[model samples]
Target: MEKLRVSDACIGCGLCVAQNEKYFEFNDEGFSKVKQEDVEENDKEELLNIVESCPAQAITIEEEK
Candidate 1:
């Protein structure tokens, strides 16, 4: 399993959302939020693409049991 975490450093740039709306979303304040705290059995490389695209460096994906 993998978990996506958004940090307070997020400036709400929305890049993560733009990259992958299925895994990311825009809140009322327009900040990008992770749609799911965790995902199972998927392409981690694609997820990493979205996380790494975050200019704010707010998104992170960590492997979990």
Candidate 2:
């Protein structure tokens, strides 16, 4: 399975959320946060787009062991 993470580098630009609200959302501090849920295999492509769109390079997708 794949996991999504938002790093401390996030600048709260809200671009990720704007791209896909189903996977990303804003936290109380206004930074982007990955929704806690299993990332389906089909969602990888879209997730990658979101990851690439992050100007701060804060989003990451990793394979689980």
Top candidate on TM-score is 2
Query: Which lDDT tens digits does candidate 1 get at residues 1-65?
Result: 67888888899877778777778888888887778777655757887777677778788887775
Error of 2 at 38 (Å): 2.2
Model 2 root-mean-square deviation: 1.1
- Once fitted onto the true fold, the runs of candidate 2 whose alpha carbons sit more than 4 angstroms away are none
Candidate 1 overall lDDT versus native? 0.78
What local distance difference test score does each model get?
0.78, 0.87
- All candidates' TM-scores? 0.80, 0.90
Tens-place lDDT digits, model 2, residues 1-65? 77888999999999999988888889999998888546788888998888888899999988776
Looking at model 1, residue 41 earns an lDDT score of: 58
